[model samples]
Target: MRLTSGVFMFLLLVLSSVCVAETYNMETQFIAPIKLPINLVPLVNEHLDSPFERYGCAASLRQSLEASFVRLSPTAEPSILVKPAESCLCGVHTCSFWILRQCGATYCFAGHLHAHSIEINQATLLNDYYGLTGLPGGATSSEATHFLFDGKSYVEEKIEPKQIK
Candidate 1:
């Protein structure tokens, strides 16, 4: 009887852990761009070109950047979503956003977009990555652009028109 109870306890513990793991949801939470990881700095420098030269932002790249961590899948590594913070990195409506995913020891660009806001849809996925909706002018915007991973990168799938009240 003691052995049976022990086995039942072990099963209960394992089932509870599995349920917790399956219910984990990844949400985007934006935060101030802190000092980037040493491995990520070079990728940022390469992909995130000089905003000063392009948009004439007074602040340096690191200063104008905001960041968020998101895991595309329950089993996948978390990816960093870097976005513009200052006015210089944005247009009248939208700002640039980039996603970087770790590959082996280093990170690589997964996607890029210019949008007022972004939402990751876990229900939809392609190439083992979550689908992204880029709202160019906020939730009330007339249209939202959908992007899906194309094995190599995220590409625009369609422009969905939204009904405005």
Candidate 2:
């Protein structure tokens, strides 16, 4: 049996919507000693910046941290979300969050963001990766930033204004 053109188009739209509707949410938990994959450790150390140079970079990072696992794509490996502990690692207003994803056999840095919270968009995508929204921290008038994966790393796409309710 052959399908009509209009039927084929409708099926295509349904499949595309199904793909877009798939999303993953990451839940962060505090981790002491900052346990991570051996291969990812170096990448994280190199990417993260610490204010305390005296303690050394790795030492400062290991001091206090939070982490979560997120799979941005269905067929891809899970990514790690590393956030600084509020007590030691956070800045005055916001803290940095690092995303590490598996690139081929080795894990690589996917993106870095500074915000109070990072949320994965449920129904938006770019380059086969999920979109993210970073909410600002503190009482400042700063706006949220939206990021989308460009096949390599997450880049800022737009500044989203705060919704007043």
List the candidates' TM-scores in order: 0.67, 0.68
Candidate 2 residues 53-121, lDDT tens each? 224434544545556677676567777777654434656666678888877787788998877678777
All candidates: CA RMSD in angstroms? 7.9, 8.0
Q: Which stretches in model 2 have alpha-carbon errors above 4 Å?
A: 1-34, 53-60, 159-165
Tens-digit lDDT track of model 1 for 1-165? 999999999999997765441111112235434444655645666665454524455445565555667777556788887776565566667667778887777778887776777877777867788888776664555576778988777899965565799
Steric clash pairs (candidate 1):
none
Task: Please report the candidate that would top lDDT against the real structure.
Answer: 2
Misplaced by over 4 Å in model 1 are 1-34, 48-59, 138-142, 159-165
